[model samples]
Target chain A: MSPLAENSGPDIIAAVIGLGSMGLGMAQSMKRAGLDVVGYDITPAAVDRFVADGGRGAATPAAAAKDADIVVSVVVNGAQTEAVLFGPQGVANAMKPGAVFISSATMDPAVARDLAQRTEALGLHYLDAPISGGAAKAARGELTIMASGSRQAFDTARPGLDAMAAKVYELGDEAGKGAAFKMINQLLAGVHIAAACEAITFAAKQGLDLDKVYEVITASAGNSWMFENRVPHVLAGDYTPLSSIEIFVKDLGIVQDMARSERYPVPLAAAALQMYLAASGAGMGRDDDSSLARLYAKLSGAELPSSTKEPQSL
Target chain B: MSPLAENSGPDIIAAVIGLGSMGLGMAQSMKRAGLDVVGYDITPAAVDRFVADGGRGAATPAAAAKDADIVVSVVVNGAQTEAVLFGPQGVANAMKPGAVFISSATMDPAVARDLAQRTEALGLHYLDAPISGGAAKAARGELTIMASGSRQAFDTARPGLDAMAAKVYELGDEAGKGAAFKMINQLLAGVHIAAACEAITFAAKQGLDLDKVYEVITASAGNSWMFENRVPHVLAGDYTPLSSIEIFVKDLGIVQDMARSERYPVPLAAAALQMYLAASGAGMGRDDDSSLARLYAKLSGAELPSSTKEPQSL
Candidate 1:
């Protein structure tokens, strides 16, 4: 009983139900890996863009999932994920029986477990797969996936997972565990980025060159993956949204909620959440997350390096 | 003229004014470099240990400073650094007129500037040099030094600096810049460690294996130099103090003060300081800084992996 054999034909038909940055890149990766991939997005421009990039595009989630052997929901949050799967014109009923549904949204682990049980009852496999590494890695097919599911769900999602990820951590045989792991990553990532912003702006206030601070820190114990990746943007004064301030505001909120449910006191994550909220509330919601430094600078009255272009509205 | 020439007859008499972990390793590095080095500590046992390690020992700051061409003050805080340099029977009045003072204590930039001015007024040079890379790197003579001073101060301190550090960042031609850079590093380092502890302990609460969390995080974007360095200690349940919780309590205290003086709000460092303070208040002050995870674990009521040995007092 091959997982792919559940479809009408031998070929695996994959449908990516989000054509955002991560989803579009992952759709391209699957297409480039010679899988038959169809992508869909609520925005027509994104769907057209995916189609223009030599991949098939669908008009709706139901239409895309009508024959997909694997349906990957790469949307933003639990609400969006649930809407795509169980709302009007939802994909769960559209997906073939025994097909796998890979949920890659960052949501509560409890939500993932509930979705897995619901989808399993519908005779569809659910693998809780949350991703890390940003847009560039997603496009290059090098994202890290923390995935968990039953054996059959893992077996079903393996092909698409292998095509899209450089590393896939099979965390457990249950759906919520992958989500748990991702929350942990988000906790650290959020805190590190906020810390980098705080330190760099503090350095700027103390009259240290931002570039020099970046150089010294990356070579020292203070360095983090977020610091090394994002501080360059601060040094260059680039606020282009590689990842937006709102993303962390959302993710760290989820982290705090999870921690609260567990009665875990994550003071650092809570602190980081406040910084993200500050940045977002200060009209930097859509700016590069590195705009955190700008928030710090604005609050401290410190001067940062000018950007290469005219400033965007704060 | 060579700074070494300021000492008697081609011998560069170097004195290490503290014999704690970092200071002891640095003293050994200088001794291995063949400088005539003398180490001093308030603790007689520490001084005896240094003597047993084939290094000369001094009973007081004056005895260590007398005739020394380079005096490295590797004490704990601003007050201690000031005491070693200017207390009753202090080093300033005992050193050769042209001798250089290399300050490795993490302190306020203003204090470093003031000390440099005071030392220069006494016909001595001062290099505001603060070190990073913990005891292991110090032992291998591979520490990173963020240093700033006058050209002559840098020139005067070069021999001792070269012996103890693999990388020397000459930040500026002023005394405070090095301390400024160091405070920035401490801000990031302290926050990263707290974030790592928060993430690992959160994972533990989620029932994810901590060792796996450590493995995944190091390979993920959540990774930091402190995370990679300190998390293994948490996994091994080893609370042996490579660095202690109190170190961050002091360093982040400096960071918070710097931020407050600049009117900069550093929420992440402030939050991290609270975690360290909480850990210290919980009586884990002398344990490894990674004991932060234990603090989180205790607070969250999560069971951590057992250590190979009997538990130390919390």
Candidate 2:
């Protein structure tokens, strides 16, 4: 074989240690990009589905990571990420030296820094790569990644990063900056969604048709990407959880935590976070983030469309 | 001229009092539509500008309204609108019978309703037509008018409205609902603008280039129309007062008052109102609304673009 052919050979092994929405898609993308990808998940169905999509299934993190060149953690939170990397039977213990870990979760920057320190001590590279774009983008291998790490780590993880992300922002040579950027992005996303819901609900209260309000706002300066994307879910009365209310609860909670630590007053983000918390507590946690409109419906005594029957009439 | 052409002659007289940004352009659009438009302003220079733009000059609202078929109040706030309409030298006492009063000031719904009742009692029609789409659109006769009133009122005002607004939301056959919808629109608009400032400011604190943030966010779900529109003003450091910070202080104060009366919690709106109030307190009341970004810069110790100097670092 030519030297180029040898360089592109199947000897490059990567592991994805979680196969949830983001992770499963990422695993499939990696596999389709011609990498020998080993995916492991706590749920057998997730692993089976990944395998069905041409992924190589591994029973455990150790099984997945043994001698692997990279391990990508796309779990729910930093805690799950920590467990996958350093917990009992964790991949870090089994992965080869010089293997890089691309941690792509929206997490506290400090936690990312801590994870970086811990992984580096274990003779591994850690790339703080917090991703944006939702699951659909993830499935299409078109995610935007806000990443920070050492040059060697980026070099080691280049192929996998290129495969997974359409645009990767090289934030800095530190672990926490990527997380900071993601937090800022989350702050705007959450506030825009909540504000959109408020406008539509206020329109409803004013007796203008909600549909017309949605249409006008799209044309007006009141429009937002979140508003345009999420309001339709409210209009359709379909809460099929493209991104759940709990996700904002987590993301905004991180924002609030960051603000508190920084002694910053994030009143809008705080209010939005509370609304997401209220939505989750009201048992709409699994619903789409657009279900935030339901909170407005509750406050105004208005009705919203629902998939089944009447959705308890708000 | 033929009888049909003679019947459609420019005898349909109207006036847009207070030749500020929105008012001046609206007056021009009226003149361009072949109406006999008499423009009035307290500022002699504004009157001069109106005269230069093919508008007949009037020293007072009464003078403007004497023979006019419609009087559009495009003043600042409720107090100014009241002064323009019912003050000692107000136009209501002078407007011709069967004429329409298209009130385009952003005022409280209750205030609008009261004005409508009074205007209607005077044998004049009242359309609660609060205008949007800023100065450029106003000049192009493409402003959006959130209007509501009786069918008779709509009919009497349709010619003037047709010359001014590109799209008109006929909310209902009530006076207050148009103002209510405008207040709600302002609530979301103010909050989203402030939120955009906050997020961009936070990103700047994290050392991301503000322009890049603007570019990515415009393409991402984090963006709002306010973000895409107003942020450029901040980036250019051009606070040329397209819309002043005090506008939001008044609008959001109205929103809070209305929300409080209904016992509705509008935390995001409330937070945004305070920020605008802060901007006002910081002596930016007359600055562009995008100057709210300055508050975040002051708080976070992030350097903002210079007003006089080009943003060399960007």
Q: What are the TM-scores, per candidate, against the unseen true structure? A: 0.95, 0.92
TM-score of chain A as modeled in candidate 1:
0.95
Residue-level lDDT of model 2, residues B154-227, one tens digit each, is 99888889989999989889898788878877888899989988887777666667776777677767878888
Q: Give the per-residue lDDT digits (tens) of candidate 2, residues A50-151.
A: 878767788889899996898999898899899989898898889889999999988999999999999999899999998988788888889999898999
Q: What is the two-chain DockQ of model 1?
A: 0.87
User: Mind giving the per-residue lDDT tens digits that candidate 1 earns over B173-227?
Assistant: 9999999999998999999999988888788778897878888888998899999
**Prediction 2 global C-alpha lDDT:** 0.84
Deviation from native of the Cα of residue B89 in model 1, angstroms: 1.1
Give the residue spans of candidate 1 off by over 4 A.
Answer: A1-10, B1-10
**Lowest lDDT 10-mer window, candidate 2 chain B?**
B1-10
Mind sharing the TM-score for model 2? 0.92
